[model samples]
Each structure stands twice: as C-alpha cells, then as structure tokens.
Target: MNIHLRLLLLAGAAIFFGYTLYYIRKKQLDLYHSIRWFVLSALILAMALFPELLTVLAHVAGIEIPSNLVFLIMIVYLMLTCLSLSASVSRQHARIRTLVQEAALMEKRICELERRIKASEENDDDIVAREAYKDKSR
Candidate 1:
C-alpha cells in the first residue's frame, strides 16, 4: 500500500524474473513449470502493487466482490504448486538416503577386505618364520 513497499515488491519481481530467465537458459530449471511460476509471481507482484487491478478484472468478468477473492485464488495456486514440489523433494531425499546407505555398505565391505588381507599376511609370516626356525635347529 505504501510507496516503499510497492518499490520493494517491484524490485523483488524483477529479481525473480531475472533469476528464472537465467536458470532457464542454464537448463537448471523446468521449462513449463518455471514459466508458470514466473507468470504467477509476476501477476501477484502486479496485483500487490495495484490491487484495484483485481477488482477491474473481476468486474470485466462479471464478478461482484467486496472480499479478497483474487488473493484467495493466488494462494490456492501456490498451495498446490508447493505441495507438488514438496512431494518431489521427498522422493529425492529418499533416493539420496538409499544411495548413502549403499555407499556405507560398500565402505564396510572394503574394510572387511583390508582386514582379511592383513590377517592372511600375518598367517603367512608366521608360517615362514616357523619353517626358518626348524631349519636353523636342524
């Protein structure tokens, strides 16, 4: 509602767009979904700057509203998007945990191999020493 808040929101929107574009170009972000997020972010930023835009649009679409319907719609969209993202994050986390478990098992196997090799070497040394002592006593 204030001038400073409006400017900050505008700056934030600019940064969001810039980041989205840079990420897209680098192939680090999803194309379709990122664009959807970008558009939603930009629209929300615009609406925040001038909330009357919502009223005007609603009126154009023959909707009478004294309440915050537009804000509710935006919130719902963000909620669904975030829910999907959270599910994806959860799946990735599960996969990473499985990979870590596998790596730990591999490391344990390597340690077991080293222990076996060392034990075999000690047994071989003991046999050689006993044979040498017998020959010396003869």
Candidate 2:
C-alpha cells in the first residue's frame, strides 16, 4: 500500500483499539454496536485511502468517472446501518408490547379482587340488618 493508505489503515486500527479499550473500561456499548461502528469506520477510511478502486466501481455501475462515488458509498452504508437499527427497534417494540399486555392483565386482576371485596362487604351489611330486625321483633 502507498504511504497515505498505510497511514489511514493505522488510524483505523487505532480507532478500533482505542474504542475497544474505552468500552471495556466503561461497559457502555454492546458488542454488536461496537463491532458495527468498527466495520463502518474502517470501510469509510479504507475507501478514502483507496480512491482509485472507487473510481473503477463507479465506472462499472455506469457512473461517470468524476461521479460522486463517495456519496454513493455513504448512501449504501447508511442504508445498511438503518436496516440494522430497524431490526433492533422492531425487537424492542415487541418486548414493550408484551410488557404492556402483562401490566394490563395484572391491573384487571386487581380490579376484579376489589369488586369481590366490595360485594362481600355488602353481603355482611345485609346480614347485620336482618339480625337487627330479628332482635327488634323478639
């Protein structure tokens, strides 16, 4: 690789290593997210490091020589990242729905118990009234 490419590769490696160390120390980001960040960063940096390859790819895709290859690659990379994020969001949404259903069911059970207690209290009052009437009759 050329001197500039070598420098870019070194920078990419440094980012990956530094980020890994930071994550290990902080325990903030998940493995998947970190890996994704590493891969995307490397892809972008590598592309910058090798502009000629991009020119050739753009040509194959019928894009003009001076076309916006960088933009095209960025668009594709963004699409992939969005897809992954969408899947993660969908899973979390399903989990939230399940939790909501469980909470609703528990609330319903509590209401049912409250109603039963009220009914029992009413029955007890009726019994007391009847007993008082019998005592008066006696």
Candidate 3:
C-alpha cells in the first residue's frame, strides 16, 4: 500500500467514525442507522491497515482491479441503504395516514355530540317556558 493511500483511508475512517458517534450521542441519528456507517468506517480502517486483503478479495472475486471492487461494494451498499430508507418512508406514510383518519373521525364525533347537546338544551328551555305560562294562566 502506498503511504499516501494509507493515510487518506485512516483519516477518512477516523472522521466517519467520529461523526457517527457524535450524531448518535446528539440523538440526530438512530443507533440502527449509525451501525452501518460504523461498520463501513471499520472496514475502511481494516483496509488501511491491511491493503493486501483487498488484493486477495479481488483475486477471489475474479476482479482485475481491487479499486473497482471497492467501488462495486460501495455501490451495492448504497443501493441497499436506499431500499431500506424507502421502506421506512413508506411505513411512516401509512402510519400518518392512519393517524389522520382517526383524528378526522374524532372531530366528527365531537361535532355530533355538541349538536345533540345544543338541541337538548333548546328543548328543555321550551318546556320550561310552556310550564311557566300555564301556571300564570291558572
């Protein structure tokens, strides 16, 4: 491994690992989501420490270039991550829809109850006036 490449990988891994920890601590990122980034940073550190591993993996995978393999792995990871995010968003959409429906139903029930109460009060007032008028006439 060239000294420059090793240094770059080490720095990148350190930065990524630190940012992941910071976000998790601040509650800005969920632990579940951060786990992937942590693993990625660890892999980067491993590659920096042992660049030979990449060559071996490339040979085993029948790839001509190790760098291409790394890029391929990154693309695959990103695609899978995107799929996971899409599913999560879909689930939240469903939950929001359910909550909105429930709220609308609750509002409708409240309005109906209020209307019924108002009608009942009006009927009581009318009955009271009729009774008072009859007593006066008698």
Candidate 4:
C-alpha cells in the first residue's frame, strides 16, 4: 500500500477503535456486539501497520489483486454482521410477541375481576335496600 493509504488506514482504524470504546463505555453498544467491532478495528490496524501481510495472504490464497482480497474480507465481515443483526432482531420479535400475549392475558383477567367485583357491589346494595324496606314496614 502507498504511504498515504497506510497513514489514512491507521488513522481510520484508531478512530474506529476509540469510537467503539466510547460506545461501550456509554452503554450504547452491548459488549458482545462490540467484540466484532473491536476485532475489526484491530485487524485494520494490523493491515495498516503491515501491508505486506495482505500481499502474502493474497498470494497464498491465489488471489491476484490484493485490493480485491481486502474487499472480499470486508464483504464477508459485513455479511456476518448482517446475519448477527438479523438473529438479534428475530429474537427480539419473538420476545415482544410473548410479552404482548402475556399482557393481553393479564388485561383480560383484570377486566373479568373488575366485572365480578361490580356485580358483588350491586348485590350488596340490593340487600341493604331490602333491609331498609323491611324496617320501614315494621
């Protein structure tokens, strides 16, 4: 890689590392989720520090273009990240469905109890009225 590209990559990696740490400290990102980002930043730093590593890896993998190899790695990383996010979203959806169902059931139960209490109160009022009527007749 060119000197300028290396420097840029180093700066970008450092910034990403700092931002990842900040997010973790602020509780904006889950620790588990941040792990991948940390690893990615570290990988970027390593690549920036040692551009020859990519060349060697590309040659070993039979890849002609080092830049294309970098792109391939990035594409794989993105796909994995997407898969992780999709799984998380699906899990959240299932949890939300369960919570909603539980809430609906609780609400139904509450309404049923409220109706029973109201009926009981009405019966008590009727008994009081009957007692008063008897006393007046006497």
- Identify the leading candidate in terms of lDDT: 4
Candidate 4, run of 10 with poorest lDDT: 65-74
Put down candidate 3 lDDT per residue, 87-135, tens digits, no spaces: 9999999999999999999999999999999999999999999999999
Cα RMSD for candidates in order:
5.4, 5.2, 2.2, 1.8
What lDDT tens digits, residue by residue, belong to model 2 across residues 1-34? 2456547655765786677669856988887678
Task: Output the lDDT of residue 45, model 3.
Answer: 88
Clashing pairs in 4: none
lDDT assessment of candidate 1: 0.79
lDDT of 2 at 3: 56
Q: For model 2, which pairs clash? A: none
- Put down candidate 1 lDDT per residue, 1-138, tens digits, no spaces: 345645765776788788888899999998966877698767758766786776787777676761255656677888988998899899999999999999999999999999999999999999999999999999
User: Candidate 4 — which residues are off by over 4 angstroms?
Assistant: none
Give the C-alpha miss distance for residue 115 in model 3, angstroms.
1.6
Model 2 lDDT on a 0 to 1 scale: 0.78
Which residue pairs in model 1 clash with each other?
none
Tens digit of per-residue lDDT, candidate 4, span 21-124:
99999999999999999998998888888889999999999999776777788789889999999999999999999999999999999999999999999999
Can you give the lDDT of residue 96 in candidate 3? Answer: 100
lDDT of each: 0.79, 0.78, 0.90, 0.90
Please state the error at residue 91 of candidate 2 in Å.
1.9
Better of 1 and 3 by lDDT: 3
